[model samples]
Target: MPDLSHPAAHRPGHGDPDWAAMRRILVVRPDNVGDVLMTGPVFRALRAAAPRAALDLLASPAGAAAASLLPQVDGVVTASVSWQQLDLVPGSDPDAELVGDLAARGYDAAIVLTSFSQSPWPAAEVARRAGVPVRVGLSKEFGGGLLTHWVPSPPDEEHQVDRMLGLLAAVGVPSRGIALEVRVPDDAATPLAVVGERYAVVAPGASCPSRRWPAERFAAVVRALAGDGLTVVVSGTERESDLVHAVAGDVGVPLAGGLGLADLASLLAGAEVVVANNSGGVHLADAVGAPVVELFAGTETVDQYRPRTTRAEVLTRPVSCAPCRQLVCPFGQECLAISPDEVVAAARRLRAVHV
Candidate 1:
């Protein structure tokens, strides 16, 4: 029942800024590629409502790649802010460097986007320190005056796409719809040479261990898809080469490593169907309008992460500890114990509907 009521209903001070007058805007989404892709609608709305303004993205390294595919984004500034999980330390004072870079960009306004588990205040503070006067963010906790326009966070059960659109609506920027979009840059040629003209993609890797489906199960799905007269390709990051290999087996082509974001977008865009775990691949496939069959884990609410596209089907089992939000599942990942048969069926069902 919790909803993103209105910013006016919760905002402490200052009226809505003149979005039209703003020349440069900074959108902060310092998260994974999936999270950035999920915010595509926000970027879309901003671009439509303020077409004259330059929309820039402040993102992590992984997120920067996704931002580049968004036509709405005029520029992308990559950094690992203090609030984010630091995989590798870039410099001694990365935070200061980020603030300085943002200040130099002369962003007239800033919009901070975050998942339910993350706090927007940290990113909002970066905007404030960078002299971005018009800062907007959604927060369940007090922002301590960091945000110029603060909208209350929506409920946990709210779909992430809807939640972000609601945040924009609260600040006078209406949604252009919840469709996720990614463009294949001219440089990233379609990778159809690696696989047949008609192929299915099996992306079997996730950043979190809890969110991954069993490699053997993915291998089973690959075999099933191959039997259905579709060429199967298993895709993953360079680090996940072993996992991708295990899932590909003999039936599927292993396309681990060395794929840029735009290239991956092109590959998924050409897929007949994409089967993936709850990872960036799911979002990428959805963004490219590829039908997806997702083996979703219970670490997060299914409603929160499920693809917005009706062309997708998500499979999950109920568990008491679901929505645990754990990087590592203490429970044996019982929530993701879906069989390959169900996944194969879902894939066929989606393809039938679309075809």
Candidate 2:
């Protein structure tokens, strides 16, 4: 077989750093909401290792929303980069301006975080251009002198949270704990009070097509939950109003497009059980300690991004085409062919445990 190792152009020996001595540090995870949420433990570890150093995050527009909830993050710099191909949030800074902004912050060190499939070189380039002396990232590809420390990417099955923690370990910063976390603002409020105090949230939307189950199936689950004497609410972004409405129907309340990240966390925190696809909402719910029933899709392995929350259940079927990592499925989405009954059962089990 051809060498699968996309070795870096130059593999320098690890440049050990005394994290505590650093004055300011930047952690880069310019991905989506879910990706940033999974980096929670990495932030906690860095905070512990360099408690006196100011810790900031470089995030995409969506990622920035999740970053705000991370108590360990001191500041957030939002950017939509060309390499990531993320659509710019209106009024957000362009990637071209990133170097200048980062340079102004005078970060002592920068750590670029990416998933197994994503290369960290692009973000590392920005850090390098900004004159950050100690830049660290993981890469199996040619580095092109972008990173000062290039840690090897971990196995595909390693959980995202663990993979991030492992990167910190390579840089001599040990993890504080492997748990997802977010802080709901004390004053944050949700519209769910109208739906009654006891309610389940059914978030039927995912960032991509393949990861989402059919809306009608979600509606069936909503109806079943309502029959169980629990109020049901459907949640989503404003763009997903129609889907949320469809899933909620007459049996459930539709609370789409109204809440911000903090308010959404409040909504999730108050839920008896949250049912969602493999998306950011699930990660958000996990962070807020909500019971979750994850209707997982086969686009990625369950173990790779599984919820670390205690009262959670993942519902997915084995399919040969799983782990394809396709944004849109060309074949049957059999992996997410979970029945509504199965989802209802899992939700009920989580609710029972919570009680």
Candidate 3:
């Protein structure tokens, strides 16, 4: 097996910092929505470390939406342009342009988070060019030369939220245990009134098809929960409305596309329980401190990636071909065939414990 722990060249480490004196900081987490959401603790830890520092975030558009609801992030910048779009284009100075734009913000330091498979060097290079003085990240590529401090990536495949907290720890920021937190704006708070006192949110879609439980199975879970007298609010993006509609038609209330990210957070925040696949919504619910019933299809390891919260209950079926990480299942999806009754049972058990 290849050594996956080394950082790529040009990546920097968490340098020696005067925690009290660091005033302006930038966090680069231009990944998926869930990845951005998981970085919430890092933002909080940074704030706890330097209570007066202004924190800004660099993320993709969707990630930016999630970041906007985080109280710890004072400002957000979207890096929507993909690496291929800019890097493959001949004579395009997109990297330089991005660096200049970030440099204009005048951040004193930055922290870049990367998984074993992802190289932090590219983002580190951008931060360096942006003139950020103290850059911090894992040292996988002998890139310690570029960083002021280099911390080893944790060997355990912990939850992404914990992984980000580890990065904060490297920079002298204390972790707030391992939990997700999001702020809901005033306007988003209104939708919660419609959900009433007791309701369950059903998120029926995942970014990858292989991770999604079958739509009908989700419908069954919804119907069962609804039959127990809990209102089931179906949630998904506008693109996922059709699937939400199909599930809602068979099971619960159709609130598809009616909630923005902030509204979704508000709704999840007030819910008694959230039923979702191993998707962003699960992480969002965890962030809001809502109890979650997570259905896993085995493409991703639930042990490693499941939300880090005591309120979360995960259900997975063991299969030899699990963790294949396939986008589309070629064979019949044996991984998702865990009986709907089993899911319902898990929900009932959770509800029982909470009651």
Error of 2 at 67 (Å): 1.2
* Per-residue lDDT of 58 in model 3: 86
lDDT by residue (38-119, candidate 3, tens digit) is 8877887888888878999988876788888777899888876445243466766667767888889898888887665566
Instruction: Report the error of model 3 at residue 136, Å.
Output: 0.6
**lDDT of candidate 2 over 1-355, digit per residue (tens):** 4555456622556567889899899999888899988888988998889989999998888889898899898999988776877565678545658899999999999998887888888788888889999998877778667888787777768888888888889889988898899877888878755878899999999988999999999999999999999899899999999999999999999988878989989999989999999999999999999999999999888998888865789999998887888989998798887899999989988999886
Tell me the lDDT of model 1 at 220: 96
Order of the predicted models by lDDT, top scorer first: 2, 1, 3
**Model 2: residues with Cα > 4 Å off, grouped in runs:** 1-14, 86-94
What TM-score do all the candidates reach, one by one?
0.94, 0.93, 0.90
Residue 17, model 3: lDDT of 82
In candidate 3, the residue pairs with backbone N, CA or C atoms under 3 Å apart (3 or more residues apart, or in different chains) clash, namely 6-140, 7-139, 7-140, 7-141, 8-141, 13-136, 13-149, 180-287
Error of 2 at 277 (Å): 0.5
* Model 3 CA deviation exceeding 4 Å by range: 1-15, 81-87, 189-196
Model 2: weakest 10-residue lDDT segment is 1-10
